[model samples]
Target: MMYHLLPSPYESQEINHLTLAYFVISSLDFLNSLHLLTHKEAVSDWVLSFHLHPTTIPDPNNGQFYGFHGSRTSMFPPDQTGALLHNNSHLASTYSALAILKIVGYDLSNIDSELMLSSMRNLQQSDGSFIPIHTGGEKDLRFVYCAAAICFMLNNWSGMDKEKAKDYILHCQSYDGGFGLVPGAESQDLHVTFIEMMYHLLPSPYESQEINHLTLAYFVISSLDFLNSLHLLTHKEAVSDWVLSFHLHPTTIPDPNNGQFYGFHGSRTSMFPPDQTGALLHNNSHLASTYSALAILKIVGYDLSNIDSELMLSSMRNLQQSDGSFIPIHTGGEKDLRFVYCAAAICFMLNNWSGMDKEKAKDYILHCQSYDGGFGLVPGAESQGGATYCAIASLRLMGFIEDNLLSTCASSSLIDVPLLLDWIVQRQGTDGGIQGRPNKSSDTCYAFWIGAVLKILGGYDFVDSKALHGFLLACQYKYGGFSKFPGEFPDLYHTYYAFTASSMLEESGFNSLCPELGITQVAAKGL
Candidate 1:
């Protein structure tokens, strides 16, 4: 009843889609079941008559490239060249697509430097924040986070105007000691502040007591989530105690009075915060909450020896479906790479896999792998890096691919890692940057998902580090943010992940990305 109202199957425009593919495959990987691949052509060919290898246009004489899709249509169009150009080098898809290829065992040797740089340039905002693309959307913490991450990944700061961008984020802070989506906005969310303060506040050498008091005591802790990544904190102990308070209502350990922690409280915890009750508990469990909560726990250093691990895992257990993917919560909403990643993250954190059925999960992911050889957010869906990362990580976590997903089949041994690696390589555009999907352009954020997955798959030796890192640096803006694709504006999501990816790649840009607040190495880089 609930899922029917959520976003339906993948729309051609919905590059980040949800379905049975990633979730089921993720579950299978969780349970150590690679045999599921024998069941289907889940990986044959897609988008028909179209070929691989990204195409690009130039921005000017200084070596700027603009990446565009020959088409965005899911179905074949009679006019092959008429397809809308995918100038939007979004942070989410950039990484998601890369991760997908990594899952399929593709090394990223085909990224295009100029195309990637152009998307990075396009997304940068003069203010320290980034936009997903020049296409336009409201600016705030989400985009800024992505932009910061993207820049960090590519070793590029050309996409942003650091001084102005930093000023813009500072302006968004409210009287309540938190940040808002936009300046002077009534909806003050701690999530926004947590992300913003880490990037924009806390002067270098990071000794700002005001920033610590403001962030440490005030950030929302319901469901135990504070931010997407850690390493930004000035005082680790303060954050630990702050996170510990959220469990007050539960029975000592992270258990259920209802089992899962309450979803909202202390401000950003609620969907409607400014006028809400004593922090109205959303009788819901969300991937955002789950991921944030567990991440907070990891940063805070809570020993699970005292916790009720089974009860919490059981809470997520209820969301699993027969098809093998997980719902957002008991609300039974959309299933995509986002939630799938959250679920996998939670299990990874707890070091447990009981809640999900693994073999079936792997089958779902295998089905989602597009004919182009990249992994998608779901079955029969376009491959995305974020979803691909969720799929690969979950599989790796569950110890799938011991013999590899395609090796066991008697009829077809064609689904080996090298083939998928080749597909991932091809997604790279003219600038040596990896794009999200076939016919899609490159962005700065995928450096982590795609890069990390390649490393995890034991094929790190194949990457062309010189071209990839140079492309990352080329995409950076003057401001502290990174853009979606080159020639586009910057956004937070990309920036954060870009930082993460860059760190993982061991690029020289790591220190400059986040010298303030002391997050030298972001999780994305670690992954």
Candidate 2:
């Protein structure tokens, strides 16, 4: 049902066939059924055919772009003048090809490594970022991460100037502690001229959203943790103070809900006028903000004792429904597996089972399991890699494992381990990258989403580490971050996911990730 129809919206993505191949074949490998694939030798040949050898191009300048095309369609007939046509190699496609070959058990020895490396080197820009294939495209962290992975895989660093690349990556860091897509651009300099130009059009400079702050905090903090440079945070006390302010307190508010939950930022409205009755309304908290708030606090080594655990726990309980699912707050909004996971993480961090009814929560989670043997956002919805991870991690955090699920429900296991393992492993497609759902293009973020589930399931041994390495390398941009899929531009979201996923595989040169918390093992120590 998933294979035949590429939706009309996806017609343009036809060039991504190579990426699709990597996803399917690599997924098969993860399932320990690569041998099930027929015509393996022929597939390998097809992938190799995309490789653009420098020798084939008459112009030396064109040779610099030699690698692999996204698909044969990228090929064009020779021009009337017989000069080299402009269809050049793509870093992403080359990566996909290499990874697929390796998954099919072919060493890279047969390819012209020297020529590919030469082309790859030429993609490096003066600013240490990379453009996927040519000089005209936007350069950013995604391509840089891809370049690093490619060089690492081929056992050559000659392709990129690592020091300069490192500098460009650092430059992308904004004043707010997050790396933006462009260096220095994410930061708002309230320059007098610029301020005068749009003073009336802008919101107050002092007003920034808390969720945005927390996200930036996570990126900066996690990046430092990954680099083992967390010790550089000399103003740890100030950082901790900033995080603690998000906490709600009873004494500070006039209502019952006060101090029972932690809102994302300052209250949306002032405290109820002392006379307000039943279930105080304004300034509700969110599960995501709570998780981020807690994680950041832990990362900064704040004393957990300072938190009103009892009230927080009480608030957490209030968010639960009879079906064992969780809502982010009392305010109406969509509920799903994500909030459940956050609530579970909160209780786990607090070391209190009283926060939630584990049995009911477990039941709700079981209800979310889809027919495909993976979990979805809600019951009977499509299975997604991110939702699946949230479901499984919530279970694990609640102390339910394969054995526990079987024993507690004896009549029926809450989770079907074997079936789920099969489903998750099959997420990897022929591209050597994993997708969130069936028939979707392989995305880089699923590396963590599905990869973490595999970690919890004890299925890492069944995975092809080398194949994943190759895909991640291929997804790298000439810049410093990773993209969501091959041939796509990189973004911070995918870049972080790539780092965490590589960490899960225990890839050399990456810090170990705490699967439950989604942070480096070192970062978890602050808790």
Candidate 3:
């Protein structure tokens, strides 16, 4: 769904236009209505526009990282001599752009496979994990998967050092039979290690304090999928059983919405009312954990045949506020776009719309939009890429973009499309990475947050693919991982988003991503 005018919340995501495109185009494909997409050729051209060709340097070795930029904001002024500035290519964007093109049936005969492959080759580390950008980030199983997918898609294995990558994946296997983000790189802090060990020894996360079980569950499942190691999980049933235990029944719930819900733990005997609620304000069910719970179930191939869907839906409905914002739990805490996005995602996953009042939710999302055409956590709050993403995604899930595509409604009737687009384009700095807000340094996560929004806006082609690639490279590290910014330590969160950002920017060598669901389209095929 699209509005002719860009909504304010989408302003911060200008860099991720390609990702937005993936979500739009892929969704159309899923509905078997791809033929309804307007300007198919133009859309394909826009995706290709992100491609970054190497400059004409004689024997260009260092500049071999040609790929695509994340957005046009990365464009820089040329030197007085008028030579084009170099923009390093990114593996993730390369793959994503190509996937978008392929989905639209764009002829790939003229694609520069050699340049793309050469760039990818330069991203591989000794241990087999591929860095997302030339500058580097985290080297983990995620990038390894991206590299492999890229090579496989290009029908070229030369892009990656496959054997080393395999070894890296193997090394990541932990004593508990789970994989961490990095190989031989589990937390080394003695205190952290001891705590983790204690955590594992405990029968459930509920018994422990300060643990976000949702993050743990998603990481475990996602890591396995990235490595294609789900088959290695011999105790699937046991894992599933453990996850299921987090479910809270109406009898156990303290709120008016007496529905079966999922939580981070079952230790809380009663739901906290809005004032005394610990998480946000009132402690109750957690939206993040609910998503993780459902996702884990799907990943485990459970088909959700045994879950109480009605009760779950009712629980979700209870989290909704009159303002259309959602609280993570019944106890009432922070009301922001994050939970709104979560609620929308949960409803989407459930194939139900009753969890929220769409009109009221839409109005509330519009309220959070800021003057800069970006979305903030609340009215008058500063615009942020993450918040912008949540707002736009919620709108998309509510059919804003689709409605624009299908109807002749005036831009004024929806969101401010023109200004929103302009604001998004302005987020890219000369460094080629996207900034979350004005005057802030670019970070890795915005690549997905802003990029996906831009893709949705159908203005991705306007970005400077090369410059964005170069920026991501600058953030990449020598050890095979990406960081939030240049020269920072790589973490799983930034690294994963970097991978997706790179994918959306240009073709690095992977299948198309399902932006809404945050998984590979191929992986989602069965669903």
TM-score of every prediction relative to native: 0.49, 0.56, 0.55
lDDT of 2 by residue, 1-527 (tens): 12335568866877887887788788888889787777789889888888765334444345357677887778655567655466567788877888888888787777767666766777887767888886457688878887887777777777789998887786566545688665534322211122222212323442454335555466556655554446767787887787676665544433334334544443333234222443444655677767777777777778776787776787677777889988886665678899899899888776777778899899999999988899999998988999999998898888877523322533335677778878988988777888898899888888889988877766665566657766876776653566787777655567668778767755323568888788877666663
- Give the per-residue lDDT digits (tens) of candidate 1, residues 35-58: 555532232121111222333234
Best by lDDT: 2
lDDT pick, better of 1 and 3: 3
Summing lDDT over every window of 10 consecutive residues in candidate 2, give the lowest-scoring window.
Answer: 187-196
Ranking by lDDT: 2, 3, 1
Cα RMSD (angstroms) for every candidate in the order listed: 27.7, 20.9, 21.5
Those runs of model 2 whose alpha carbons end farther than 4 Å from true positions after fitting are 1-211, 252-260, 263-281, 402-412, 525-527
Best by TM-score: 2
On the 0 to 100 scale, the lDDT of residue 186 in model 1 is: 36
Better of 1 and 3 by TM-score: 3
lDDT of each: 0.50, 0.71, 0.66
CA shift of 335, model 3, Å: 0.6
